[model samples]
Target: MTPDLHWTVTVDPLTLAIGFAHVQVEHTLGHHFSLYLGPSVKCFDGILEGANGPYVGVGVEAGVRGFFWGTAPAGGWVMVRGVLASLSTNVPNTATNLGGYTSALVGFTGIVGPGLVLSGGLGVSYFDYGVLEYGVHGLAPAAHTNVGWAF
Candidate 1:
């Protein structure tokens, strides 16, 4: 069977203009489950209210999928996958009052592929805003979606 490769772009709800790229890899793990790993780059829209500045973050996600439709060659599958990610960003020295922060996010992704797949899902993120802080703390629920090619 041929392998599946795809690129996913997700736009954040809070910062609609800001988006991230995920390089996705899919592998079959038997009859019911498939494994996927995505290394991503997330860009923020310059800290909230000018408290800090925009920063780039690096992270990775690992998840498994349970397929519910069609098979390998026919080209359509509906699968649910769970992902966990750790992201880090640097705070500018000019913003000494602000410190670097890391975030942990967990989310469920549903993918349907038939040449091009429509992807959408919801997630909750918990940020440990080290030095620079604003708004709420701990966990926040967010949603995302994207349209991209699937192969």
Candidate 2:
């Protein structure tokens, strides 16, 4: 990380492909620690269940990261992240679903150019749809890559 760098704004393309516009912002707290949070807007359009009709919702992610090598927001890092989402559909009299996941991830962030930041990571995520109606709760493989500008 640049000595004077304080913030970064990043986007996940994979999340966009799946119908969520996800963007994250990271801020350095010290030489080895940082905090990141983001929001996601989704339009599933009943991709998972036909009866649900159009599925729309919002999601959020908050996490703390620790850098073991290099400086904050650069080189190797580990993070514990928690995500939450609330979704509802066009179906009448249906309850909105609130779900999210928590993950532990390891990755590296590098500056490709002057201010271009690139990052990738893999980890296991514990996701609980937060509704027994969906019976969706488990540990799943997680992967992510982000491209952004560091300043």
| Best-performing candidate as measured by lDDT | 2
How far does residue 63 in candidate 2 sit from its true spot (Å)?
1.2
- For model 2, residues 60-92, the per-residue Cα lDDT tens digits are 888888999989888899988887889766667
Please identify model 2 stretches exceeding 4 Å from their true place: 45-54, 130-136
lDDT of 1 by residue, 1-151 (tens): 2245333333233333434455556556654455666665445553344323344445565555454543332233344333333433474462423222233233334445445444444555554432344322465554445454445
lDDT of each candidate versus the true structure:
0.43, 0.76
TM-score of each: 0.49, 0.85
Model 2 / residue 56 / CA error / Å: 2.4
Clashing pairs in 2: none
Listed per candidate, the RMSD to the true structure in angstroms reads 6.6, 3.1
Judged by lDDT against the true structure, how good is candidate 2? 0.76
Candidate 1: segments with Cα more than 4 A from true spot: 1-16, 44-52, 68-114, 129-131, 134-137
Strongest candidate by TM-score: 2
